[model samples]
Target chain A: MAVVVMGDVVQLLQRQPGEEGPISDALLLAALANGDGNALAELYLRHHLKVYRFLARMAPLDQSHLDDMVQNTFLAVRQGAHRFKGNASVQSWLLAVAANILKQHIRKESRRRAIAAALTEIPLETTTDETPEARLARQNSMRLLGKRLHGMSHKLKTVFIMCDLEGISGSEVAAVLNLRQGTVWRRLHDARKQLRVALAEYMEVDT
Target chain B: MTRCPGKEQLTRAISNDSSAELDAHLMECPVCRDECEKTRKLIEMAKGLPDGHPTSQTVTRIADELRATRPERDLWASARPGYGVVLVAFLLVGAAVFAWNYVFYPPSGPSGSANTNAERRDSPKGNVTASRSAIYTHSIEHKGYAFDEVVSLREGTVTIQVTPLKSNERFMVKTDDATVEVRGTVFTVVATNGRLVKVSVKSGKVHVRPKHADVAILTAGGQWRRRTHPIQKPTAVLPHSPDSGVFPIASPEAASHLTKKTDRLDRTDKTVPAPMKKKETVFQEGWSLLRKKRYAEAANVFDNAVSSSNGKDLNEEIYFWRAAAHYKSNQSEKTGEALTDFMRRYPQSPRMDEARMMYGWHLFNTGRYETAKQEFESVRQSPLPHVRQNAGLGLRRIEARQ
Candidate 1:
């Protein structure tokens, strides 16, 4: 599966699988475990966006921490590559690591916040195309979304994000979370019920 | 209406895990259908929020860090099943021998005893002593008094007195902030919050290298300390101070003048009463507070000094130091105000480049990218190579983020 030894990963990935061109994610991970830096870079280019998006949604309170979280996720991938047993897809494994790191970072941030109650509040990022009213509405919606997500329990949040938003299967998420499939379905139910109530309130407020 | 499908069934259907039974129920029951639709729309709203797409610089930084670090070796990946059996047998045998020796030959010497607080040797008695707050350990090899040892003090203080060592010997006391390399000297080091706060030599000389500063040789009765950021390399060494008994070193000229004045005071006034102690200047008081990391109090003192100043240079220093105190203490509003005031009052200050870079990062972090870009652009023209390089990186980061 490790065919292209010295060429660009993008070129290699673009070719058909039957033509001895594309490397599988597992093959790249095997090379990474074998200390191949090129394989690591390839895997990063392939999956960084997914990992970044997951962590961004998970830790919506601080957009700045996304970069650090992504970096740490890939670093964890390199360190834990050998332990990948193929029970779940590589994307599932990557998200699991990203989720763990996000949890740790949130815990640390909470402790810091307790010690120093006030942190400098950075202004929200603004796009030139957004009008004042639209911007306000968007900002309010996002703020409410972040608030609800942040308020949810970590388990419910992880399950909802993985199953509902990222579209990973419940079984894949169960393996990543080390929980039974039944528990995952149960948590997803609770998460949906809570979010539905929130959505009702939000729609009422909007009208 | 008939009891709707269970919560798990509804969740599965919403997540597109549709079965024939759940589909028939959702088709018939309007309540379940409405619930599913609203929940799906809520999930859609969540998916619509913008992802925190990282800049390319973050990717490059992580790649660089990964390249610099070596991956941990996985030993079992290549090991044969027979190898594990053999390894377990070997470990069992080794453990038996160790256990036999540990029980039968229960060690008796001072070198053999392990204490929770201190470590020592029989021959080199009283060489290392530490307070309860200090955590340390020591080991002596069979190199014939060529003692090569290290004491790691994570925090607190440790005092060491070692005899003159052979050319091959090496001894060091490492702290969070600095390393004190002993040349067979007697010295004390106090570290707090992961930085060396004080180092005093008693009988011989020691070379101290603060993690962020240059190496400095300090002789007996000489002392060194870190009072602020980027602790400057010492150019002039001297005894402790008379007023506070702690020397606060700055530039070479300042250290030299203070040394001479301290020497004259010691030589002429050997019998001066304690009540005749000279009062400390406002700057000195504020400086002492800063050294103690009492940043809020130090900022207040510097603010007072700024208003009462009589000279241009001193006034500039006061304003700059006040801004620094505000920055260190995380008083964001006060920090911005002080930096703005300093830049307006002293446009030609020597430290303006540093101030601009600091303010640039402050603005950048606060999402004021345009103003941050201007600050960084101005700093990029600095004569200092490091400052210019940092400013260039800052500009690149701003461009990437925008």
Candidate 2:
């Protein structure tokens, strides 16, 4: 388990106030819990863009599935509001839930694919020439990384994503993943090493 | 040949304290210099993906969906009418309805009248008839409070209107298999078929204890559903306290005074409430780690903050900090995930505008450009001028690329 050390956190906490009042979240939560329609709307207004974009990144670019997952995630939060303990940041916990939801979606998709494989004819692959060269290159890199990400061990990949991709501090990653700070550091180092090795061939192509 | 810094040391040196020793090493060693440049390039390359934005249509659709699926208010309305009277009224009304239906639309099978009568007579406080055909009636009373009640439980559902004996004082009802605890509040508990228990806390806190499980406290506007058996696992109980002995349900004034005294006592001793103290320490630690650019470590601190407290305020703060740390560390996937989570968890957070901006940036970095542009465009509509300005800048950047 990674313990986020005390001294490092204090510095971040000392930054300029992003927003004011400690009681605001509680008040908003209370309103939501009470089934205040306006409160729920207000909450949506505040977070809709962020959550929608996040889902779009994680899922397919198609709006239907992305919208459904995002909607379901919010619905779950609304239903599970009371169970929320103010332990982790509301965002991290929600992300955990979203991640879980994504995992479930992947599992369901895999199952659907398996069922389809058993019952339907296979489709042939087709290449597209519509994307620009630069765009194609960028897409290739993202696809390569995404595929490689799935092959890495859970802990290593999570640390890599949290630190290198998401910009979370090693300590914060430790807290979210419940690993020690040192372990988070070690895993991050190992993950980067693995990625470097695994993507070496791909990087050569780019160069 | 020159000394080459280990990966961890180099990473720490890049993100942590800028010491002269590390600087000196970097200045002297070509290997370290090359490694540093490579690391920088890797980070930049990873972050260079095209951004995307959620369309306005998507945003509107989500808002509409949220409005549609929000929980009904009827759940909390159960707690207000004074427990005893509500219970009695429910019993009377239910019996009338059941008798009317039973007589007018009797099932086409032999009914066990004797057993049903016996269950009706003996079922109250501490006893339940296990037979599938049995209907149980149970009641408990706290007399000095604003409300008192004798609740009748038929099957597994309970109707309650118990008043709070004191502010912040909790009135917990425990059964052999489950407990529905209430405070100065009104609520209802429906334990369907002895397998699942549903609780709606209209006001105050409702703590549910099922058999051997540690108590789960739910506040006003909160509801909980749990299985009777699995949650009874042994690892749930908190350590017993000397002050854990049952206190008489006192008047609201007395309860408030007692609560204050307890707070004072808790303060005098270093034994701060676990939830509050946990938040302070975790927040402090998480913030410090974030400032040092040790994002992984900061995230861990935020995680501890969520696990140690039930306060919504702390949870929201932790989410914001975690999002910031993820963004700073350049973990686009995790950054987006954290922002999404923050939005879902604290949709009403005042810092939502900032979260939206970052989320859009994460999407863009991950090569989801159209989605990023949409998010930025939405931000352009914000009431806050600064937010709108930033959103406009983001939108222009996205559009200009195409």
| lDDT per residue (tens digit) for residues A74-190 in model 2 | 666666555544445555545555655655775676644643342222121234754577556556655555445545665576566556655666666566566787887788778
Cand. 2 TM to true fold: 0.36
Error of 2 at B376 (Å): 99
**Chain A TM-scores in order:** 0.76, 0.60
Cα lDDT for residue B180, model 1?
81
Taking the tens digit of each residue's C-alpha lDDT, what string does model 1 give over B1-402? 456888777888999887888888888898899878778778877887667677788778776776667787656855689999999999999998777545543322345563222232345422888889886666554343234567777777888887765454477877766788886788988777555777888988888877665567788888776644223332211111112322222432233332222211111111232342212356566666776778889888887666665334355556766776776666778878888988998887766776787677667656788998999899888765545865777788788877
lDDT of 1 at B109: 32
lDDT of 2 by residue, B1-402 (tens): 346666677876645523677888888887787666666556565544322356787788778767776484445534565876888999999998787545543322124233232342232222222335534554544332212223333355554555334231234544445666564566666654543256676676666666544456777777766532211111111111112311121221222332222211111112223454766567667766754657778776775666556446474667777776666666667777778988998777666766786676667667777998888877777665555755676666677778
- The TM-scores, one per candidate, come to 0.44, 0.36
| DockQ class, candidate 2 | incorrect
- Whole-structure CA lDDT of model 1: 0.69
DockQ of each: 0.29, 0.16
